[model samples]
Target: MTKSRPNILLIYTGGTIGMVKDFETGALKAFDFKNLLDRIPELKHLDCDIETFSFAEPIDSSNMNPKYWVEIAEIIESNYNLFDGFVVLHGSDTMSYTASALSFMLEHLAKPVVFTGSQLPIGDLRTDAKENLITSIHVASLQHFNEPVIKEVTLYFEYKLYRANRTTKINAEHFEAFASLNYPDLVTSGVHLKVNTDYLFKPNTKKRFKVNKNFDTNIALVKLYPGISEALLRAVFSTFGLKGVILESYGAGNCTTETWFLNILKEAILNGIQIINVTQCSGGSVLMGQYQSSELLLKLGIISGKDMTTEAAVCKLMYLLGQNVSSKVFKTIYETSLRGELT
Candidate 1:
């Protein structure tokens, strides 16, 4: 609401984008992102006012877990009112996971939280970090009628902005490192940045942002394979004291109709372990009951994941479990889309 400038927070959680070259050794090293203004001189030309905070000991995305997610959430929570928007510099490997976690952790958010990273070090001339970082900030600080646009968590890569949880890393060598097959790009870069206004979610600005930091990480993913046995199914289902399970079912959410396999899943559900049915395919949805192979799952009261990506489903389930909501409500809420991350 300030006329001077929108204060944007750049949270550097360590990634290729935050790396620089050690001239003597010519080795890539993580630099203090608090000196972001010194390295990215072009940032001064932007209209928005910016500030940064970096992890004390920068961690690669591979080491990311619930503990780190709590740190990021706490940072945002502590500074929620001070900044108009946020841009997270994170490793591409777990960016989707963190983004998905945040979408649920940060409830009723009315400001953009954009996550972007690069494949090459920022100090490299061939780096894509500059464009990704700059554009992500612009997208975060963007406003119309003095109201912030993109009031949700998103991942901007190449020239497309995707709902973070709905996306997955598709290629290693390509500049387009991520893709949201189940969802459309919220914005596309071109002669003029084209915003998908109709698809973009508009949060109720009156609602206060709430951070849900407590997450139960006791979750497991099981992928169905051909010739899989009852013993394997039973073992996978037996995650003692686990909070949730993401079952990566075959095409169209199809799983084996074998009695043992079905019984194992049925027992897990009965034991109060939340299980979500997601498809193994990258693009298609888990259309439960669409084929006979998956009919048993529907009959067993297993929750259909619909078109949710695995990343989204996992994070969502963790968030829901953390709240300790009743089983009935968890089922209802998990199937519902709060941040446009799922269908």
Candidate 2:
């Protein structure tokens, strides 16, 4: 008997990585998925077989939403049994958001779904697309004893692989476009792929893989700053059909100690609105009650999103709200790390 080569699927969702410039006209166009292997002959050198899938109409990551997320999940679900792993090519602008959303949308994921993109077009002479795309596929195809080594959603950028939900896009021009401040890189691509096995998420093998397409987008994000007005806060909290809000506060989740501000938050929570407290800083966990300002928020039932990126918090709230989780235990569940989005 002979061992079968792993089949890795390249899902192109559209981004800088897929664009190619015509030498004659200089006009950029989407790269056809059928010619993927032709364009990148280096792929033939990999031990695994490769396949490609593209959206009927390519979408920029800026236009990405819940509908597209469900589409991606459906693609994975439809081909779940056939492919060994998946690599999603997305735009760097909102890669973190899409990656985070996918983390929640795909439940009990036991295969790698590595999201990656480059800062330049694939046809550019100085492009980073080839390296990012090639390495992502390799990472996806990694296995030990015929079992996938990474069994979770991940984001690979520059030379680091991070847990999808833990990542945030910190730069626009630099090839190092993402940062996983709260968590360590799962793998580092240098002279060799060094995988931090202990940091990788291990899913329960017994649980069946599930695709969660239900995501409530009726939520808002509010970033607190000095002298934020009570009227502005009132309008946001009172928005019609708003089920949740991601409150990005100062370090350690501290916020205004004003009576008016506290009153508005209390009223909103009392009205059954879910409020999640996330830190505004790029790194650090939210420790409610550590300070007087944040203590009231904890007492008022605001969920502490400890060490979670705003991207993760937003998607988690959407996923939880879509499940129709009862208000009674929403805070408890939100605070707990459901998909390893938080510490």
Candidate 3:
């Protein structure tokens, strides 16, 4: 039997949630997390022992990258047995990417790992930080039959809990900073915290928590647009040494049937680079070959990212590439939903 007091590790990566107001000038700035408990007095009341570790110099969410993903994974890996759960405070900008990457990096996780951040500074009067921070910890510490309840990566925002990889930041200015258009909420908070058990992911208890820290971020996103020129297309496809491409195409994943564009994509795929076709519009799946333009992509062996958000597609590609998996096996893994990251 486990102790009633759950042990949670709070990883504070730079973001709005950790910011506070400068007492005299009233300027909102990142707070020193050394005094985190003093800042949030309510944490003491929870039935959990919380320990925090902040970055030496906090970085804005925009600067988040694959390196940081590996760092976070290492922290969890080193302290896996000590903590019952982990809650990460991150910026909303790249929170989905980090969450998604973590989902793949931390394999066979049998405890909750919830990522959350707020739109406003924590020290402000009407900041959304209070609720987001508190609720994330609550969700992290949740248990059933004396074991952790949620055993996967998750994002909690605006009173809703969603699978980490399935989420996308939809609103920048609003309190509801994210939405999982490809998937349903894992839990919703109202009169009582409701857990959608049917939609939740159950880990393979048979496998060990294998961490893949080597993620390759050598990827690009190409959104198809009308009147896209040959020079522009050629430059994008040839400019850098790209390992993968997330092609955000028109409805149903259609693109121009131009010979030049077709050849560029075919050459890339033949060179063993992955090209994932995802829909540009919300609430739809990418159906390759459903139209003439997209047929070119299908013929060239491009992979259909059916119902995957651009965020998920990009992060998943990076995660897969990090494993140094062969092109054939990479396709098999990308199209397969390993952690409920895709439909």
Candidate 4:
């Protein structure tokens, strides 16, 4: 008996990883993905049948939003049955955001959805795109007992594979551009691929796979700074149709205990604006009520975001708001880890 090769789909959403330099103009341009296999001949040697799909037009990651997030989810849903795994080539700028969004969007996802990109263009002499792309596909194709090994959305960069919702883009100029400070890396690539199987997500295979395309963008993310004024907080709460706010607070989700600041947040919670307290630090959990300052947040019924990155918290808020969960349980639901995003 012999094993069969996996069928991996390469989706080029947009990124510097798939660009080629135009020598005459000295500017990088998006290359024709139809020639993807030609540029990366090494892909032919992988034990998988590869197919490529490109968006009609590439988008810069800075402009990434919920609309594009829905588009990506639909693509995966439509092709779910045909492919064993998916590798999304996306810009590193918002790769963590997109990865986090998809983790919440896909329900009962039993196959790998790996996202990867490079800091430098593919045509660069010292490009990192080839390694990232090749390894991502290989990771997506891993199997055990004729079943997929990675059953969650993941972001692969430089040489590490992280749970998508646990990742944060920590650097803009380095090859090792992403980090999982509060969580462990799912996979690490070196001389041999070392998978931390204990940390992998396992989905309920009995349930049918479903795609969640609806995402409400009526959300605000505000960071707490010294001497922050009331007017700015008022402006955010006053935004028409604003449904949620992800408040990035100081260490352990603490903020100024001033009466004015507390009143504004209390008012928002009363007015049905879901306010979440996530820590500003990159490497810790939000432990509301652990200190006197954060005790006020716990008393105000502010939802704790725990260990989730700001990128993940933002997407999770939008996703949950779109689901229209009632205020009575919204706080409880957000505090729970729907996608292993928080502790």
Candidate 5:
């Protein structure tokens, strides 16, 4: 049952948004969330009951990995019944990867899991942290007819809410740091919060909510370039325990039709290694057979990562590989959009 006032859980996984100035040392330090109201009194105005949880030690998003991703999944699983929604404070760097992993790991989501962070510390005079933090909680708290307005993993940044698996951190120096190229924003924040209901993911709430923690980190991401060589390909393919590869192919999923290159990929597949073809371009779908260069990939049965961000492809590969499914099942599911990740 939904509450009269949403009980929002704010999970701090560490980032600029959680930093504050140390008066004695003048160094940036993680702000204690126990004094959240004192730090950001703006939160008090939202019509919700807010609770806070912090990682035992802050992990920079650059240091985020599959184990930490599982830790996050466990936290949500343990608290799923108590909270209406969750807001994750993460470092902007690699935030999209973490978000995408969570989307796939958390099956049958029925509440909003809004991931957000800021470019500057919350204590800075001109910080963007306050707006990001307050609005994320408000977004998580939103309800209509006693049901959650958002029922998917999402990244709320700058002023837009995007499907987590579709997002990419596009800029480093700007306040607006993320973009969802192939997909549209689920919600926009301006004078008032505006939701694009048609774009929101409709989950199968009847299914039980659960978490998948066994992520395989034995995959590799290979970005193709104009002068990439056979030796380089051979070395990467030879890595021990390597189960899958996210091949960042050329525009429209094209790659050299050269026999040597194709042979290496062919050998990998024959040796029981899976390869997925994802576009290097940030804004297009990987239509495998659209061109002569990409046709071989179709014949080779390489998985097509249609319109999926590299971050999503990487995380999806990890999640699926961890499942220990047969190659046939893995390819079928990897090509399908389980979390609205690909168009």
Candidate 6:
């Protein structure tokens, strides 16, 4: 008897990785996915069947929005039975945001959905595209006893594989562009692939996979700075159609305890606006009640997005709002970890 090879789907949604430089003109142009195997001959060595799906009109990661997220989820849902795993080629600029959004959007995912892209174009002399693309495919194809080792949405960059929602793009010029500050990496690629099985997210095998396409984008992120004006704060809270706000407060979720500030926030909460307290610092969890400044926020129904990346908080708010979850239970659910995004 012969063993069957896994089938991996390669989704090209546009980015630096999909570009090739013209040798004579020195201009970059989109590379056709039809010639994928020819350009990267090493893919032929992988023990898996690969298929390609290119977006009709590729957009940069900056233009990435909830509609595109839904499109990606729909593609995976439509082909769930046909492919064993998926690799999404995206721009690194907003890759973390897209990855974070997808993590919540795809519930009960049991197969790998690996997102990867390079800082430099594929045709560049020092291009990181080939390695990132190849390694992501390998990571996506990984399985043990016919079950995938990584059964979640993950971002593969440089040599590290991080849970999608846990990652933040920390650099613009380096090949290593992302950092999973609060969570340990899932895998590290080297001479041999090393997977940290203990940190992997295990999905419920009994539940069926479903895609949630309804995302309410009526949200705002308010990053608190020293001497931030009351007018500015009021304007943000009063944004038309704003249903939720992710307040990037000072260290450990501290904010001005000034009476006016608290009143503004109190009014917002009273008007049914969900305010989530997330620390502006990169790596620490939000201990809302630890400081005097944050105590008022905690008492006034502010949800603590403990240690969750801002990207995850924004997407999670959009998802929860779309679910039309009752305002009474919103704070409890948002504070709790639903997709390993919060500690």
Task: Please give the CA lDDT of all the candidate structures.
Answer: 0.87, 0.93, 0.88, 0.93, 0.93, 0.93
- For model 1, give the 10-residue run with minimal summed lDDT: 232-241
Least well predicted 10-residue stretch by lDDT in candidate 4 = 1-10
lDDT per residue (tens digit) for residues 64-105 in model 5 = 998889888888999999999999999999999999999999
Error of 4 at 209 (Å): 0.2
List ranges where model 4 is wrong by over 4 Å: 1-3
User: Which ranges of candidate 3 are over 4 A from the true structure?
Assistant: none
lDDT digits (tens) for residues 1-343 of candidate 3: 5566898999998998888889899787878777877989898888888899898888899999888998999999999999999999999999999999899889999999999999999988999999889889988998888888899999999999999988888898999889988788998977678999999889997888888888787888999889888888777778577889899999999998888888899888887789899999976898888888788888888888988888888888988888888986777778888888777
Instruction: Indicate whether candidate 3 or candidate 6 has the larger lDDT.
Output: 6
TM-score for candidate 4: 0.98
Off by over 4 Å in 6: none
Choose 3 or 4, whichever is better by lDDT: 4
Any runs in candidate 1 off by more than 4 Å, and if so which? none
Q: TM-score each candidate.
A: 0.96, 0.99, 0.96, 0.98, 0.98, 0.99
Model 2, 21-120: lDDT tens per residue?
Answer: 9999999998997998898999999889999999999988899988999999999999999999999999999888899999998899999999999999
Tens digit of lDDT per residue, candidate 1, span 25-93? 998888777778898999988889999999999899999998999999899889988999999999998
Instruction: Find the 10 residues in a row with the least total lDDT in model 6.
Output: 1-10
**Lowest-lDDT window of 10 residues in candidate 3?**
232-241
Per-residue accuracy of model 4 over 112-142 as CA lDDT, tens digit each: 9999999989888899998999999999999
**What 10-residue stretch in candidate 5 is worst by lDDT?**
1-10
**Pairs with steric clashes in candidate 2:** none
